[model samples]
Target chain A: MALPLNYSFRNALVRWRSTIATVLGIALVVFVFVLLQSLAAGIEKSSSNTGDPRNIMVVRKGSTAESASLISRQTLTEIRYFEEIARNENGEPIISADVLVLASLPRRDNSGEANVLLRGVTARGMELRPQVKLAAGRWFEAGKREIVVSAKLAKRFANFGIGQSFKTGSATFTVVGWLDGGGSAFDSECWLDADECRSTFERDMYSSFLIRPTDEAAGEKLITRIEADRRFKLKAEKEVEYYRKQTMTAAPIKWLGGFLAVMMSVGAVFAAMNTMYAAVGARTREIGTLRVLGFRRRAVVAALLLEGGLLALVGGVLGCAIAFYWNGYTTATMGMETFSEIVFEFRVTPKLVLEGLAFAVIVGLIGTLFPAIRAARLPVISALKSI
Target chain B: MSANIVTIRNLSKIYQQGDINVTALDNISLDIASGEFLALMGPSGSGKSTLLHIIAGIDRPTNGECRVQDIDVAKLNESQLADWRNQNVGFVFQTFNLIPVLTAYENVELPLLLTRMNRAERRKQVEIALEIVGLADRAKHLPKQLSGGQEQRVAIARALVTDPALVVADEPTGNLDSHSAQEVLGVLRTLSRDAGKTVIMVTHDPKAAAFGSRQIHLEKGELSK
Candidate 1:
């Protein structure tokens, strides 16, 4: 049946105060949802740089990246001779044995000190990461104390800007360049020359080696070749799956976010139920009049439901608009993967906005069902008698 | 002397409050002919409204049968009764019952929406209803903007919009001032006397009852002629 259009729209507008409250309540819930999801998202983005299919990582058998037992510079050259490794046009192996170290620095927000990763690499680091670009400054020099800070770190902390100097025990290094790796995990660090990093950090056999396999399909065989020779004692992983596993590294945070979303959403559902139930109760006489005027019980129920659904649709749109302001808002988080501060921003993509709206509509549907049933179940005789 | 549009046999209604099952209507049987102006009169708790509700298919009798327009009302399900009401009955209340959000024109157009009438036909029907009530000028005004008499007139317009075979009005002027009550009664009198429409009204006011061609009184759920 074609509903009385003015009846529905007028009732909604007449109760502007309650409508606003419900909308704001929904807005708050959506805001919290976005914040928690964004943090979980940041952690995933920071650790997801290892997803390259043809690339392989070789870490020490006994430790993870945070506490990896180092490999020798001579061993790096020796491993370059392996047949499973790819070579450049000049016959240079597409292999890198980089130095990874952790340093604690004070945060700009006075949230105290946070640990950050410092990766030292060779000239081939640029070729290995074609996606990397200098967003603002040049690349670090070959053997100087000059270093390039990751774009993520640079944007998040004031102390890590170009030409800024930071102490690492007795030595101080100058930030001569700034690098961006298109939002990968590498953008969460500072890059220096391997020899310079060793001198500044004062001791590093080496952290791990990142390898490009000769054939994309030969990754497993290369791991077998390295493991067979007991001299190195290393483990290998395909880069993509490795990054995917790292995303699972923050399971606790994801669990906490999910738990909070579920709990607060329950409260929101109750609010919706109460408000709609009150509306139905107050309109008992009107419903009776409708019944007497020949409108079916289902039509009355549909009108009540449409009221709730309309409220939710308005709230969802406002909530999404509120989330949009958070797009690309940079922040620092202590990443569990590398035990360091990872720079990330809120990623309020179109997909996330749509997911948020879908959630509101579901909540709306659940909230309206009971009230509509109560309204429909009321007898026309009693409804007419009702005050 | 005429075909009975409504027939009731041994109809009864009981209202239970806590421990008391106070009988609102008891063992009533009657017949109402089509195109008749019948007014029902009673004191509080006299069951005049109860009988009206039963005849309108809104309230089922606890014991007995109520057949309106040849169909057993008690036997009809809620949906079917609703369909029957839409097709055959219109109701007017003491409070007018015009949707407060709607203007007089929109209120009158409500029942016509259930029919297959397009907007143009619905508008024409609404205009005729308003003209009959002499509220064509006030059609754009909301219920609150109209007077008690004007509001009731709009309510009457709404009732007649669907061209229902039977019109039920309970306490049609109970809430209005005497002058406004006279205006509403005048319109209802025109409906019954001039247009030959069937109008069943329940009222406590003897003055209003005098407007009907025939009067039926109810005392303690039993009928009195």
Candidate 2:
């Protein structure tokens, strides 16, 4: 098994052009690999599978979000007193009024329009979303003409820092502060006081009401109680469950990334395989010399395979560098749950980089095995005669 | 007196490609001394190289008993044959078949890597082989950087690096100019006389064949001793 380990190493170094081309091919494959993984991560993160779970909303029975519905204050107040309702941390019945709107704004990259979901909240709204943070400046005065933009949205938009003014219709308001939400989807939006947003939009009724169970054991009971009240004729679902439905739309994005990665890798595989095959062919004489000198057939094959794996590793490093430079840089996607715009940063974590390199090495294995085997199997007589 | 280091009896090689069954070697038998310098002289397609190849244990004979140093090469499998060749035989090709990427020193060191010798000892052996071929000063020069004669000398060094007694030279000077050819023949002559190698050379050139202590002519795969 004393194969000349330097056989393929020398060939790869000698044919520098083809070697670099193979490396570049693997780099491209790795790039696709990272891109696909990020797409899946983005979609998965956008739909929080945990928050507001089992908390039902009754919005016009069929309306999807605040912008699509008009539920009267009378109906919300009446539902607050329902006997089957649960209590909050304050020992009060779990109910809060909310108004939602679709506010279209110009994208920073393009002049094209993009929508940011605007959720106007009552006083109890702040307590309900407990994990949310006021990262900078101050919360808006109850009736002030100021709004707190999500940290992600503030970073995404142009000139959107504190005290900056933005316009919609005949009204222009100053950005008062910023908010953070522990990486939830709400970080990609703006929050306003309920009455202010209502007056600005000239709406006479609330869009939706959020509910919490007394002990979460009362969740189904509350749902049945709300649905049975025929006067409002409401349809209810847990808030956590409602967001999960967005996963169906997000599924395509995940698959799209995977499909794109596979497609790109095919070209890379061809490049690497073609290069390795030619490399094997060109070194037949050298292979024979090794065998004649005492190298086992499997040793020769393993040496060539190692060479290919090293080439792919180099490409993987370079491709990962390209992907890493993009981490935390914000980019937008359609919020599948709301059909509005959601922005997130590219997250090129260490784990993803390693997986990219691993994938590249696998591609190397696919590229070099057959060629290496052919080289190892060559008869020493004919191979030596090749030169 | 011939010591009979190699024995061949009724050896044949047939290449079958679907409908074509080509006989490359047919019922060839020969015996030579341990340190004899013999030349195989024949025209193209006379199966001289085929016979040399089979004797070197690089190819199997269809029906025969062939032995080198009393070990039956014909009975050995592919891997065993390879190991036998590595320990007992070294081949110099017409093309000087030095790895293009390796310098003269590296090419010689290549065979030594198969041995148990460490890097320091391997370097010493390679130096001796190169010094013997008169290319010790040019050891750093790659095959492409060396002249035709120098390249063939490097190949000769590679062959001698393992200290194999049986050196196979297949048209070793066929690709060289007259000057390079003369230089190569001079080295082969020195190997037989000074190093006591049993050299089997296949060459069409009368001048190259003249270097061998004796020459055997092959006509249509049959040898005339």
Candidate 3:
């Protein structure tokens, strides 16, 4: 005979202490799973939302990132006059010859050193990226040892506030302003004049060029033209596409997250198993009574499994709630591609919460399987004899 | 006289207790008529419970066969035996054995869940069973909430709820006080005499055995005719 479902539910409630332990253990594991997935999602969104689709990014051939690409002054001049390039209101091609470098700086909260991205942009740089907005003070003057820090970076590092000066190598740069990048990847960088950066760093070449095309056909033709030129071996991809590729930097984080979840799940599964085993032991006489009353072994197994599933379902919802309530909380971590600190907020999407709930159910199934089988296989005579 | 409802042929049960074989039942042959209340009385290790379990289709005999109402209880497989017991044999335990979590009405409705009866029909049968035990007003009370006499009456209602051909009870009043014990015995007496249900009860108390129509004794795994 099939056992009624209320039997299992009442049994679980009657033995609330053990049920609470198993539920809390599963909840902790699910909480960790949700947060880790959100971390990976946050990193991916930061990179993918970086650049505009209308602009073309020029980097040296085989260069994986802008910091590794080097464009000479002659090469930058040659590429500025292309017919496919869009002209600004002043009839000048909309281009930004930028220099990229990494500087070690001390954190405000901790004295330990961390890498900060130092970028030097040309005159048209601010116009090229409309997402960056000057939040305070004013833009740095040309040919001066002055820099503009991102508001996020200014909050994270020491001596990067407006009007503060920090020394790197043989040069001292004053932070004259803070610009907000609207959660884009540029929020990790400090910007200054390209010429001053080259002179101070003793480099004769720019890192990369950011250019806007007139239209879709122009964008396509510009990429073909840039790659076809024999004078400079370079690759041109849409700025949006280039930033999307930067998400590969989050691969290790995803792997580490998965590895940690698997390790913790083992403990969660064991905790659930232990709880079920104790329940079976305590209910041996009850099982025998049911068997004597003509209830089948399959019915007993189903009842026990239902109890475990109910516990895990409740735990899963609790865990998802814990993760969702903390959404939009900002945190910073080292960027894999740029080797600099990138600030992002926790993004606990509905899809990730659903995945967490599904994970809890699977763990519940795994934990209940062996114990249910053991309960079903118990001998009617022996179970009856148990006190 | 009522016709024979249970027929046994040289039933024996042997158990292996870690290299030592213990004979729980030895060459027992008996017949129990329908509407008869038969008591099997024996000391500890006397095989009375073993014989009862075999007749209840819960245990297999090492040798010989047992048949209840034309179904060979010994030949049926585990699942088939379980189904047979559900339709034919109701059980009464010494401890009342009511699930503590279930109310008295729910406990009575348990055996009927095996059948294809709908909810309304189940409720009707459970109400009637509880009425027979005079606990109709206590149907919603959990086992722990009921007194010893009330608990044993609820167990009797559960046994009779399915209207089975036979009720096998092992020491049904062993844990009850004298007053509650008499009440449980009176319920079993009414089931056999008025309702014509065959009842096989195993107990060591002769006073409890006096309530039955006939008595059988078992000694050292053998029956005393």
Candidate 4:
């Protein structure tokens, strides 16, 4: 017959000091694990949440990102008149020839300089990306040397607030407004007039083209048409797919989180093992008494394992709660695709909390296995004789 | 006479300590009748505790048979022996050996947990056992809260709660004072005489042995003349 669960629970309560120590040790490890994982989750969310599936991006065939792609003004004219391209109310083609440039700026906290993406788009470009909305002030006029910085970027970079100006390469640009990207990749960029940015940077070619097709079939035809034209040396894909590929920036962080968690788990397991071994040592006579009472060996092992699992479950909950504190808290990291600071928030989903709890329980159960067996295998007569 | 509850024929227990063999029980043979209080007395290393352990099914004899309730305990596997002990034998130890975290009532209810008895039925048995040992009022006390005598009485209640046919005690009164020892011995004597349990106790003190209906002396693994 099985022993009562209260037997295991009460023994743990009696040894509160060791119990708390092992719990906190496991808690610290899990806390670090969950936090790091959430950081990567935030970056992944930022990338995946970007771009509209209806719009298509055209970049140089071998370019990894827009900043590296260069398309001549001649190619923009050739693709603008395609029959599959959508038309605006004014009968103009719904296409945007855009420029992407990197500008170094000082951080608000004076933590040196970091690269920020400055995107230059035509008025039609603003219409194509309806997700980016003006949070404060007014949009910049063409040829006015005015720019609208993202609200997230404005808070982090000096000289980015409305009406402030920052100099770059003999050109001073004024911040006229703040735009909100709703936690998408655009939150890491500032926008200005395409002609003005071209003049300031002395670039005669566009970095990429943003196109809107009349329908899904038209979108597919436009991509096929672009790929067939060897002269253009360009590739076309849905904007959402392009941005999704940029989530590689989160891969290293994911690996590091896993590596560090595995490393810390080893120590946590040893701590749990030490605590359980000491418990067995202290309760040798009690074990004998239980055996004499007819509790089977499996029952003894099961009881000890339950005690360990319960202890770790508490630590898991504590760690998840600690990680939840950072949820939606904005943070920044360098994007590998664009080589610029990308601002995002920690995302702690319910699934991650469950995973953390499961991880802790597995570690606890493994740690208790050998010790429980040792306690069960003890010779009953000799154990009864021990003090 | 009542039927024999325990029968041992030429039982021997040899322990291999390192390379040398030590004989704890040498060709011992004895029979204990139902409802009899038998005490085995001996000095240190006399193997009195070993003999009691073998009879209780906690240890196996090297050779020969130990039959309790008509079942050969030594021939049974470990799992079967555990089940057999739970159903037919209860044990009391020298230190009282009460689980420190459990209350007196819980300690008494332990052996009954292994049985198929329901909670109310187990409670009834535990309560009756405590009343017999005169510790019914102290059922809520933990082992540390009770005096030496009270702890031993609680241990006795635990042994009797299962209502087994055989109760084997190894130095049950060794850690108690004269007053507590007398109280514990009186409870054991009542269990055998009034409740009809066959009790085998191992002790060195003559006073404790005198409380039993029959006494046997062992010296160096051999019964004395």
DockQ of candidates 1 onward, in order? 0.73, 0.45, 0.71, 0.80
lDDT of 4: 0.90
Q: TM-score of every model? A: 0.93, 0.83, 0.95, 0.97
Q: What does candidate 1's lDDT look like per residue over B138-174, in tens digits?
A: 9899899988989999999898888887889999998
Q: For each of the candidates, what fraction of the native contacts does it recover?
A: 0.67, 0.53, 0.60, 0.76
The DockQ score of candidate 3 comes to 0.71
Model 4 spans > 4 angstroms off: none
Q: In what order do the candidates fall by lDDT, top score first?
A: 4, 3, 1, 2
Clash pairs of candidate 2?
A: A86-A214, A87-A214
The order of the candidates by TM-score, greatest first, is 4, 3, 1, 2
lDDT tens per residue, model 4, A54-74: 999999999999999999999
Each model's lDDT: 0.80, 0.80, 0.89, 0.90
lDDT of 1 at A65: 57
Q: Pick the candidate with the highest TM-score.
A: 4
| A270-329 per-residue lDDT for model 3 (tens digits) | 988898899888888889888878888999988988888888887888888898887887
Question: Clashes per prediction?
Answer: 2, 2, 0, 0
Assess the local accuracy of residue B133 in candidate 1 as a C-alpha lDDT between 0 and 100. 92
Q: Where does candidate 1 stray beyond 4 Å? A: A46-54, A61-78, A155-158, A202-204, A218-233, A249-253
Q: Which scores higher on DockQ, 1 or 2?
A: 1
Candidate 2 local lDDT, B119-149, one digit each (tens): 8998999999999999999988988899999
